[model samples]
Target: MKNQSLACAEFSESQIHALIHLLSDPDHHIAQTIHDQLVSIGHPALPLLGLAERNQENPILLDRLSSVIADIRFTDVEHAFQALTTSSTEEVNLEAGAFLIARTAYPDLEVQSYQRQIEDIANILKQRCEPGLAPRQAIQTINQHMFVELGFKGNIQDYYNPNNSFLHQVLDHRIGIPISLSVLYLLIAQRLNVPVVGVGMPGHFMVRLKAEPVFIDCFNQGVVLSEKDCAKFLDKYGVDFDSHYLDPVSNNQILARMIRNLVAIYQKRDESNLAEQFTRLLNIVEPRE
Candidate 1:
């Protein structure tokens, strides 16, 4: 438990300069020590960091800051944007070569569709869950009964199926992938009061559960497994997961994963622009501590 004062007591000019670049907006959500470390860096950066912190919840300020960052020439990336942004500082900068703002593909109104589906999933899960189940317990029950035992699969065709029930399609894997799992996890967790979030993994859409000491891969059905399992799963499919599964991911990393999943699928289907937009979203929903 290092205090801010202790943490930044000996920061050098280089450290401060380094932090300016590393202090990507997401880092501010982390602790005072990180904040202190930035403040300790040098007085020159303090005003900027202070101003940014002051406007933490201001959406306008956020957009402006994001714009400012977009303009800066990212040299070596200092500590890397992911370090300053997510609760877990493990995700690599997959967006380094990508664009800053992700374009909307589903139309603004369609965002509401995501919300509606979320509610529907919640109601269904509520019927199966005990009213007072703990977060982990509820997750376990859902996994055992629905995902694993029942073998829910996300077949691509269900995603395009018009007459099928979205809820039923999701349960049976007709909705395939990152979207279905993302919606499922969010809805079910809402019932249990767990704050688990989702991240769009590269080439895969996955969920991130807020567990002690780390976030987990819930898309694998409440397995709470690590990146090692990710690697193993890829190996089973003869895909080289090691090339990209380098470390445990952050919240943003997971979002990126989700976006990547969509992007890959879209790209495979030749929807170039949608792939680009999702790639941008991958950078947006990172989870910082």
Candidate 2:
């Protein structure tokens, strides 16, 4: 069995070697043909290319191989994300959905690392809560920890940067767009049993206390807002006020909105490949004809 495994490994390595050589071909059509063949080999091509990349002295061949490996990694993430959409659970796991989206840009991201970061914040909030504290007071403590102490603010300077859409990046940089920040706030609030729900307001995202008439705008340092305030903000933006907009969105709906944001950003930047990928993800989450 060992010998057979070794033989198979050698065969795969030999195939990779031939493909790498053809990658340097002068003809564009030949190079594309070689690229397609390697990608068709799928995940198996990744390790072989990694070994070749380490030993390769040619810069052009190395660059081409790197691009191919990236595409393969992205395709793998895309497949996994699509599979999650068809999961048996009624509502998609929000953290998992966000992490899957993050993997598109950060293929090597450690999901547990981000989860731990969120848990740590929740733990601190848990410790800070006074025994039998009012729900509103408890929420204020969370806001102070998240926005003031931790300094998580909106990335208003570069609001359109695709990085703002990634949860992991938001955690690292302490800044993100409104929707990403709102998602982070919602997740932490849920962990702390604060009864917060995401409010997918038009052109703005926020959270609302389940039994209270209060809304929290996470992008603005968790400032509490009244329903009338939300209505006024919407009116100022020329969006008709709809009470339904304040309703708690499902995990799938939040994910669909995130995907839509990414699609718009990519399309604006003329990144058709990425835009198409997110569009497909959006369809999976909210299928349309």
Candidate 3:
């Protein structure tokens, strides 16, 4: 493996500054070359790029710096994600996978801060979870805390917003699409020792208690549903219902699905570059057989 420090050390500070200054060149070819060079320099150039980005007044130059910074950040995310996928563990850490995926959109995301937020929420719910509480009653308590107190809701007004696919953004806004919301619920439930698992049903995502035949539609205010209700949802969406859809998914599958959501969104919006980025992540998570 090439040493990143050694590779970056080849470019003197002055040379890196010159390249950043040239990023706004009027000539497209010159600007493209500068961009490529900065990207190749990788993380070592980030401190300079970030400083330049903060002081930059020209919108074009600022955009170039931002792009380079995002590229550098994604390189790290890709390496970490690959390791997570290739590790020997049978069950990957779902929270870690989700946060890593979020880092793609928010390069500077505070992963530990968000983790602590989830932990705090779980702790509060744990106190409310009384001894000998029935599964359904416990779910009701969780639903109230999540939807009513915390104010998490389905982002129905702008369902296709890309932010809905990011874990940090979802936590910040308290609104997200099905899968992200279900992820939040699952994460908290896991901490509380609740017998809940993510249910990647067709066209919608939910969580089901392990001890009951009940499914909770996190996107819909945590409304409880039966297996038949899930089948109806599938039928309404023109998807053939299969029993396997209710099975718990691994962290790898969940991350792949999140990336798939972004890919489809970007494709629909004609943002080919963004779509390609997420598609690459999807392949990393669930590579072609």
Best by TM-score: 3
lDDT tens digits, residues 8-87, model 1? Answer: 56665566645544544454454323433443333344556546645677664454444333222121121233343443
**Where is model 2 more than 4 Å wrong at Cα?**
1-11, 27-29, 54-63, 130-132
Cα misplacement distance, residue 126 of candidate 1 (Å): 4.3
Candidate 2 structure lDDT: 0.86
Q: What TM-score fits each model?
A: 0.40, 0.89, 0.90
- lDDT agreement with native, every candidate: 0.47, 0.86, 0.87
For model 1, give the 10-residue run with minimal summed lDDT.
97-106
Put down candidate 2 lDDT per residue, 1-289, tens digits, no spaces: 3443453455466787788789989897898888777766667677888888888888888877887887777777777777787866677788899998998878899999899999999998889986777889988998899999999999889999999999999999999998899999988987878888888999999988988889999889989999999999999999999999999888888999999999999999998878887887787888887
Candidate No. with top lDDT:
3
Candidate 3 lDDT: 0.87
Tens digits of per-residue lDDT for model 3, 199-265: 7887788899986789999899888899999999899989999999999877777888889999999
Candidate 3, residue 186: how far the Cα is off, in Å: 0.4
Per-candidate Cα RMSD to the true structure, in Å, reads 14.9, 3.8, 2.2
Clashes of 2: 0
